[model samples]
Target: MTSLWHRRRQPDDVPTPVAVAVSDFCRRAKAAATPTEVREALALLADEDDFRVRSLTDTEPERSPLGPFAVVDILRGTAPELASQRQGCGYYEVVRELARVREEKAPPAPAPTGLTFAAPPAAPSPSSETPPEGSTARAGKSARQAAETLQSRIAPRRREPLAETEPYEAEESVSFKRALPKPRGRFTQVAAPKASYQTLLHVEGKGILESALAQNEHRFALLKSLSEQYNGAKGELGLPDLEGALQRHELMDRLTSRERQGLLAAYTEQRGAAGRVAWSLGLSPSELQRLVSMLQLQAEVEGVRERFQREALGTRHLTQRLDLLGRDKYLADLGIKKRFTEMLRKEMEDLARGELPDAVDLPGLCLAIARKHGAPQELVLRALERLGLSEGLRKQLLAHSNHSSP
Candidate 1:
């Protein structure tokens, strides 16, 4: 009876008893993945000793190596280990293989497309200036001192936006309007070539120093060489021949993309800044900017005047012609508008520079200045009214006019 029972249980057909049990477990696991997929994975337990046999979930490091377990116990279904692995990254290959072994009855998957991507470039690291070598090591937080040192050196009047070389605190707000110091000579500055060369060498290291000086000198020399260039081209458009255009192009192309932008920005800033300096010394950028504009306007006016005379047009007609060239509804209005715009740009520059524009139309200029300075427009108007400043006197007020006490 025992031999008959053994034969009934051990019929030799498809699967062995052990394999059948495993396949059955896998089939049941496929329903909801018997928590064994999370079990330390085959890859985690994969080893070199292929001939060495071992049961699944056995910690046979000499044979399979590593853990034969995942976060949770398969039979119990609790994963305390995975909670500790939150910081680890994923490896989808192991997860896919596990799923495949468990769900064999499912249809085959489509071939995958291969994709490759490069990592992005890293940001520039902060420049660390090691303070004089053997001196007592400075506190890490002393970056404020370095920032103050830098501010005292080059950035105040250059009107540069401040950024630090190291970690630093935010700059506290201060009144932008301050009284101008007593004027010396021309508000315009003429940087001595030799002195400028020295300044460049001192500020920038040897690499850019000579190059920057050479670039500046080249521009200056180009202007000198093409003395007749600004006279307007002789070929109908009044444009100059620009004989040194090649030199300018070469100089510009030699600069890096960033350097070119910085150079142009600096020049524009300097142009506006010089005008403001002139304003602080009792002149206006409007007059300077307008001088160039008016020079062209003068020729246009003269030509139109001749045309009007030859055609026997009325005075109103000539004035209208000027207005048309200037693009104003009325000639007189055009003049006024040009003057106002010129003055506004001038005053705007002044608000940025150390001084303010003189009080012309106190309320109007004040509002313009206020807008430039990011202050309330009505506040400036109200202040002007309270001060009882005459139109002419108001015109005398500098951009500093906003600061009541100062």
Candidate 2:
């Protein structure tokens, strides 16, 4: 049987009927060849008034693998406008389909009113009209009168050009020059550019030093004192208290990418302090373990091994193995025989490299360790025997067992 530790967690909530139907529709939409087909599939759910169906439309692709949002993204390439419109309104696709159906079933619009108006009588053409008797003489007289009036209006406005004008004369040119200021009797010497403050530190190191110095001198000294005090206080704190303090301060969220990398470096510095480093960074041991696994997986996927040092890798692996042994005792409380046997094998291997105390009762020690890990004593002993426990320890354990069996 697989250990509880190895089993994946199942989601707590069962999917509703509407959500299941919507999910099925999304799957079909994903397989669709075009946006129209996808829309057609969605149209089936237009009348589904259940709110869960609508909620699924906006769910993230990661949470709902074949969600409506994902299907819309797939349709976007082929039908950008439709995709955009649908995205703007969750019910757009459904409303549009309903509107289209309504339009198809509705009666045709009434024809526009056809009221007509009479055209005005056409003006009589000049060529088609016959002049009245002496009408030509009257028209000629009117033309003569208009010409005379136009000449009268122009006569008063016209004036003869000036008879004479003064001859042009150029003005005499005048020049002025700017006067230069008198130089002072004494000259000021430019000081030699104060030998560019040389330093052995790199740019980053120099910046840090400069920042520290930028503070008030007294404040800088006080800061140093406070840092010392803080370090002492941190060292005195128990693991749980330290973790709580870090959580209260939200220190992990405050750390920058560079600071996080530095923290990782610190974690790798000491193999045994992995748990301590994790807690100091406001991470639970499980979170730290997951982070390590993620890093390893990322390195494998990217085909890059240099990112993590050999020491770091060794530390992480050791931390993971130690973590297995350090799991909550309740995880093994089910006491499955096969799982206990497997755990016993691992525990025996772990113990093989260490010294066994002559003063201790071997059977009792084994039993205690197994019970602490929620494993059966029989399985632990059998595993120890199979994995070659030291001959002397094995004989002592067996004798103790026989003696106690009564």
Candidate 2 on 302-406: residue-level lDDT in tens? 222232222222333332333333232322322232453465456565653242432256666666655556654444554566545646576765675676676
TM-score of each prediction: 0.15, 0.19
Tens digits of per-residue lDDT for model 1 on 113-156?
A: 43323233333336745444433234333544665565555433
Model 1 vs. true fold: TM = 0.15
lDDT of 1 at 175: 78
C-alpha positional error of residue 26 in candidate 2 after TM-score superposition, expressed in Å: 5.4
Candidate 1 lDDT score at position 263: 30
* Model 1, C-alpha of 244: deviation from truth (Å): 5.9
Question: Each model's C-alpha lDDT?
Answer: 0.34, 0.41
